[model samples]
Target: MADEHRNEHAAPHHITPLTTYIFVFVARAAGTLLTWFASTVDLGWMNTPIALVIATTKAALVILTWVVVIGSFVWLGVLFVLTFADYLTRFWAIY
Candidate 1:
């Protein structure tokens, strides 16, 4: 039965081209530089959202490049949960 199942299903294979890897690396580096530059600018209320957008884009790129699509979604779900938890606990004035 095991042999039959193995024969029925082919092994998973993924081959990313070198250029794709190089592009991802460059994009990540650019995202880092952009994040740093955003910190220097005084956008006041816009700063946090801008930073979050940049960070999310970088994370999505990494997740999609290195992991399966489903894995990316799972990771994003976990991040959302963590962010929500942090938001919920922020106003805790338990003195």
Candidate 2:
């Protein structure tokens, strides 16, 4: 009875495989479309920033929909570490 109770309280991995496939397909499609649209515009210096923002948004949506909130948090942590590395390198270059 105790085991059953514990199992019931566990985080449910209820997302079906087909749901994951759909999410990946949708994200890829949206990302590609955004890239194509952005290319047609003359944002110039803002192009890279716009593309990165769009890509990150698509990635986050896919991650949240398919892998859930926990996976999104883990990805955010990785992004933070990479950002910190960039900051450290910039600071060290002053020497």
Error of 1 at 63 (Å): 2.2
Q: Which sections of candidate 1 miss by over 4 Å? A: 1-9, 75-91
**Per-residue accuracy of model 1 over 1-95 as CA lDDT, tens digit each:** 65655754677778989998999999989999999999999999999999999998998887878888796688888999999999888877864
What C-alpha lDDT do the candidate models reach, one value each? 0.89, 0.81
Q: Every model's Cα RMSD, please?
A: 4.6, 5.2
**Backbone clash numbers for all candidates listed:** 0, 0
TM-score of each: 0.72, 0.55
Task: Identify the leading candidate in terms of lDDT.
Answer: 1
Question: What is candidate 1's CA lDDT for residue 22?
Answer: 97
Winning candidate number (TM-score): 1
